[model samples]
Target: MTHAETAGAPAGDVATEQASHGKSSLPLLTLGAIGVVYGDIGTSPIYAFREAMAVRPGVAATETEVLGLLSLIVWALALTVAFKYVFFVTRADNNGEGGTLSLMALARKTFDKPPVWITALGVAGAAMFYGDAMITPAISVLSAVEGLELVAPNMSRWVVPITLVIILGVFFVQRFGTGKVGVVFGPITAVWFLVMGSIGLYHIVQNPFVLWALNPYHGIEFLATHANIAFVVMGAVFLAVTGAEALYVDLGHFGRKPIVLAWFGLVFPCLLLNYFGQGAFVLNVGPENVVSPFFEMHPDWALGPFVALATMATIIASQAVISGVFSLTQQAIALNLLPRMIVQHTSQDQRGQIYMPQINTIIMIMVLIMVVSFGSSTAISSAYGIAVSGIMVVTLALLLVVMRRNWKWPLGGVIAFGLLYLVIDGGFFAVNSAKIVQGGWVPVAVALFVSLLMVSWMTGRNRLAEKTRRDEVPLEFLVENLAKKKPTVVPGTAIFLTSDVEGAPTALLHSLKHYKVLHEQNVILTVRTSTSPRVPDDEKVTIDAYNNLFFRVVVTFGFMEEPNIPKALALARKLGWKFDIMSTSFFLSRRSLKLGQKSGPIRFWQDRLFIRLARNASDATEYFHIPTGRVVEIGTQLII
Candidate 1:
């Protein structure tokens, strides 16, 4: 069945089922949530405060300015992360999966036809994630290692080189998987948060006046009165909530309850205490202490050890985003937003633990370039917020649709909610936009390139599918003709993989034209990606026998799943097809595409790029997990 055929069942049921499954293991899930979901946002304190203080580069930050900035950061976290994501956006998940793409999938189901705008938003959001993936490690590790300057001034020059080394090490270990070290990520991060809170609490006691920043009025007054400096300061202040988006993005791994419980119970309070503590310590000592306020608060004896802890926290943060990008790439490929790449599952027990060498290498190169070019955490901070801000805005837009359609919220309520958050998200995006000349252009440029690449792939794939459907013979016709004038029947079953289930596959056509024989049993197999995140095993395969000679089979895998054709095909036995894997041959068409004489829907350059992408796509046999010994590839040349 197609998506439309399967849409009869309620969508939220899967999410509810997924939620219930995590209830028995709530404590463990919450711990894992704290480790993975909060890792990125958890490390914000290292440089967020210092960057906010540097709004006026040479001048010492005044008490009002410090309080005001602290107020802005706290409110941003409260409204943006706490309220918008935890309380609301998570409600719009697609079959227990959350992310821009997941939300887009949910929203797309509301309409009879998939909306182009929703797709564009999803593509744009996913593209921006790559930018975030690259900058996250560079900025995070650079900020953490810069603490060496506080431990020993001479080590300041080693910050960039050391950052590069740490990043290299992080990517190198990815192939081995994080499952082994993942056990400690939670306890370590929890300890890190507690220590941050403890240090903050100690300073807040010394200078209770800093607590005044907790009031929202200070944040509002600062924005209203300091118009000249507020814009630049707003961009810097956003660093505090940079990793907040990860909460919604990783919603599928750990369910909603555990994530919410972990946040409200521990992560949220610890962050507030630490931020307030930094504020108090800066006010008590002097604004000059703001140079490295996170490290400054630590006792001389603990600075080295604390710096090491911070480095660990940052590496975990980096790992979280890197894993996230790999997941995003998988989702994109399943949806056909990008070309296929190698996805290696590193752990048998954990379905989500995956490593993509191409994505890892690409991110490593980009991160090293940014670290070498920016040279400091403070410098690279300019590029940090743009992609995140853009993603927030996209997620918010998609959420409005989900509210109006999926949740059955009134149009008025949806509008009111959208307007409220739009201003907040729009304000951050607007402020971050000002940093383009100051290195923000890097992510923006990367996003544009990636978006174009996605658009090219989607457009070209659609065109090719249309052309193939037009040119191919209908399966019904083929079955009728074969029955009338039978060719020599071969001994075993032959499964021809195709994009269109209704049509005879290209590989089957080529084999018959050259060899003049049909297999004793022929199967027309179509693998589909469902809108939901995961399909149940029982519903994975549907077998439709057109005649004894040909069977039309549709194997549906959810977007978040890795497709294993052999395993899925084994399910056909339940439908009365005598399955024998060793005797079956899986036939695939390998298309060698070239530029056509006349122009197509896409421009010449985009067409060429699309051809290039098609050529580099991962081998279908390996991607589909078909046994190499039983796979046969038929080459076909095509003009785009």
Candidate 2:
């Protein structure tokens, strides 16, 4: 089905003009929001400087080398952040929502069964994002908290404790919701840029020649002078664009215009200045000073304040990534890429402030593991760039499909952007590939596991759905012969759970064959999980009368949400659905799979494992909150 039809948007308005005038202030709000959401990219200044300095192992931190490194930093931001993301990728948002999955959804709608290459690339991108999510908080927070050591040499030992405390505080406050705190996030992030710019400005003023690094020639010259060193520099340059993906992923939270404005108007200038400022500081103070060039940019009196500001900025940066992980999980669920988990909305009005206990716990544990394994920001940085860069390559490939199918951009334009982005992204990927032997495998390993789980869940679900469809009985025949003629007179409502939206529900069919009659009030329910994270509660459940004998109720959930059948039924009652929870019988159809030749090679093992695991699992009645005593289960065997 088309996005508009599925989403219930008006038909003619699907490709209407952008909502510009009515939402003018939205752009400004978006800019500030982008600053907060995109802070991870903005704050790379903390570690990017040190990593770049380490590229040339034996060379002294000379003015020329510093200037050359600064040049590369500026261009990296310009090419990757400005040219690629802000100018190009932002324009490819699917109904203003960005990210690989959204783009893929748009492609599927526009092209209808897009090429396998496109789908594969998109999935790879999504798989890699999981790896990026696991490591971002670790690197971002650790780098920020490590600044404390600049104030007191002995305080270096306190970095981990302080970082843990700050992280705990951040996650603890999630229940209060981000709406209240999100209002200030933009302004705080804005100030962060200002502080970063101001410090960079101070250093640049002391060493005015640093401005010469703006020339691309300096970067090329640096590479020519030290070819071997330049190869290693890719790893460092990769750090400069670490958070670039967030810009596109968060396009929905804020519009494209504001992000564009912020990137060009404020963020771009501040980042370039600070990077050059770091270079200037290093040039004057030398190699030893490179360890803490950012801190040393300020006076002795301001060191404490500098550390405080860095801490806050880092926390905000990490918070954005953690929240993003939640958002990604929600999207994955909506697209049927993962199983439904409990997704609690934290706010009454804001749908974005959602809590997923399963996802939250998993991320927290993975992040802690990353911190313990890597031990410092520098080591984590090695793993960080590789995952993000690989994902970008995947995103670019998908974007080409979007341009052709959705935007109808010329083949030439699509090809041009595709080739250019691939080159830049592919080169970075190759550079990061070198680090795989040096602790970079961590994120790749994480991505592989996530990909396996995602593939397994999707494959298993499809197999089960097919089995159920084949075994299902026709509703009209059952209602006429078995249910209508019988005088069994079953009491109360019977809620039969079925995976399909149409046809006779399997549980109801089974009930008729065994018990010979349907309940007085029967509800055939199908729960649909949407691709978006949150759906309006009022629109959560859809009800229709099926020949006065069966009520077809489909409960929809955002990927980031859980399905509480009991609570949904309660809400249904408020909407005039008549069913007593105490008296209603919840019937679920359980499928048992026998290994056979019908299933695909990739899914044979996965389907077998899921069948065994699902059989011993708690019945849907318990999982969905149906009263235990009123629940019934019917099993069916299928050859996969």
Candidate 3:
């Protein structure tokens, strides 16, 4: 099925089911959710518990401390992942799509015209998400591969190289599409979760006292007593819910029902079991003897199989991140924050599966660099908290704006929700404050770099738009002048693609100036990308025909949908638009940008950056899917 067909499907699995199995596919969809949606958080059991325990400063191993830390981790998942994201943040989705950009688009739709701050917040959040994306695969895969150390301590040196090889293979297979392999993702993850729960259960039964951590007071008392250590430990404790955003971000693919069922039915129980089981082991055996508690939990004979299973689970987790960045890149292109890049549909059977070569290459290089630099999962754990914490805080901040302004909640109600998450998020963010020089700087630096790119792109576009608007003549004036001048009428159709449909296109003006003739049927075609995710086919086009043998056609596309001019024009048949591909000539303005002499809303240096970006942007003809044979490129220069 194409993206257009699945656009209305309830879930990714449902889409596949409707294509193959008709309507009887709820169980399959829920299982599918297990594989894709919960991959990241599911794999956390391998490292999160160990990392949190290791972060305690100057504290001896004790049952009270173990229980306390476990309590904190459990509550963090409940409040942050379950309550904050699934409960509230997911509810703020824009037309069934959820993510930083989708939320930003939704916020933009909430007002007559939103302020600049909304755009800034969205960029910040998105940049942070990219930073988090880099860290997730590095930490998740390494953490899983690091299990080799428990089975064969001598093979510790090979862990990094082995992980790099696995990741490299994953990236290599991306172009071939994951449709065949993706079928088993749900089953593997489901089994992984079951194993995690069983192991934790066996250990938890050995010491039921671990259940005491589930009580709120032990966690409160632990924090109250060990304030100093508790602060630092919160950073590691955050690892438990690091990829919680996946739950919300992948909601559109899985839908609310299957994702919710997968979560409440299996993912949550298994995670709690593994966490509490680790806590129990620490309480009974003491932290000193617990050499990688996660792997060591199973029988000695199960070690090899456990490692193999873990490696697969982590790969699935990393796949989620890779797929997410592709979607985010697509959104950025649609929103005009980033220049257009080639987006290829990876799976003809799956609508959401897309691959961008440039983005895939960038992520591959960065992820390898991260793995080589960090060496071990334990070393990279500190950096993980920073990226996840930064994203979470930004998400919560945006959620507050949505509740108060968009939802029109009472002031008291908004503040209550704000304070609820703020206390939890503030502590996690604050812990990473001390680790800036020790790898925490990586993601923060990345977020800043990405945010800089976005801001420069937007700033340049705005100022350049203003500069062009000043020089543009109204379409009415141009039409009246053309009528008086009596330019020769040509036989073929002319389609001038313009950003501003009401103004005369530079290409159209140039065509008239140089060729000295107007086409029999002229169209000022403007493609407008809306803030929504998908627009209905029936309402996709609007046409305005003036009396000067001229036409103004506006094609609307959702931010999630790709623009195809030929396809869109086919729908304009009712408006007397014949759209003969052989006879239609698409005119596009190719502007070579130069830096402005002085600083304006954006800096001179920034303008240079913008020019660089504009020059590298995808060709208008290619991006709009226009036939190359019918495209006429008119060149010009613009200084801004």
Highest TM-score: give the candidate number. Answer: 1
Q: In model 2, which regions exceed 4 Å deviation?
A: 1-28, 31-35, 114-117, 476-495, 501-503, 520-523, 529-546, 551-586, 590-605, 608-640
Q: Score candidate 3 by TM-score against the native.
A: 0.95
Candidate 1 TM-score versus the reference: 0.97
lDDT of 2 by residue, 1-640 (tens): 0011134211111221143224447556665565565789877888887888886767567677877888888888889888888877878765557788776665665544456665566667788888888888888888877877877889887888776777677777766667777777788788889988988888889888999998989888888887886767977987988998888888767667667778777888998889888888877777774576777777889888877887778778877887787777767666766655555677775546676667777777788888878778888877778899898888777777767866789999988888877778898998898889887898899888777777776667776666666767666666666445665766788888776765687667667778776677788787775544445678787888766566788787644345567877677876787767788878876666687876676667787666654554444554466677887888877776
The sequence of per-residue lDDT tens digits that candidate 1 reaches over residues 1-640 is 0111233233563455364354447788888889999999999999888888878546666778778988999999999989999999877777778898888888888888877899999999999999888899999899889999989999978888899999999999999998999989989999989999899999889888888988989998888888888899999999999998889888888878888999999999999999999888887788865578899999999999999999999999999999999999999998889888999999997768999999889989999999999998888998889999999999999999888888899989999999998899999999999999999999999999999999999888987888888989997898899899999998999999988867889999999999999999999888888888888788899998888899888888888888899899888888898989999999889888878888845578888888888888888888888999999889998887
Q: Is candidate 2 or candidate 3 better by lDDT?
A: 3
**Top-down TM-score ranking:** 1, 3, 2
lDDT per residue as tens, model 3, 88-135: 887776667788888887777766767888888889888988888888
* Poorest 10 consecutive residues by lDDT, candidate 1: 1-10
Listed per candidate, the RMSD to the true structure in angstroms reads 2.0, 4.4, 3.6
Q: Where does candidate 3 have its weakest 10-residue lDDT segment? A: 1-10
Best by lDDT: 1
Candidate 1 achieves a global lDDT of: 0.88
Off by over 4 Å in 1: 1-24, 57-60, 600-602
Q: How far off is model 3, as Cα RMSD?
A: 3.6
Clashing residue pairs for model 1 = none
Please report the TM-score between candidate 2 and the true structure: 0.86
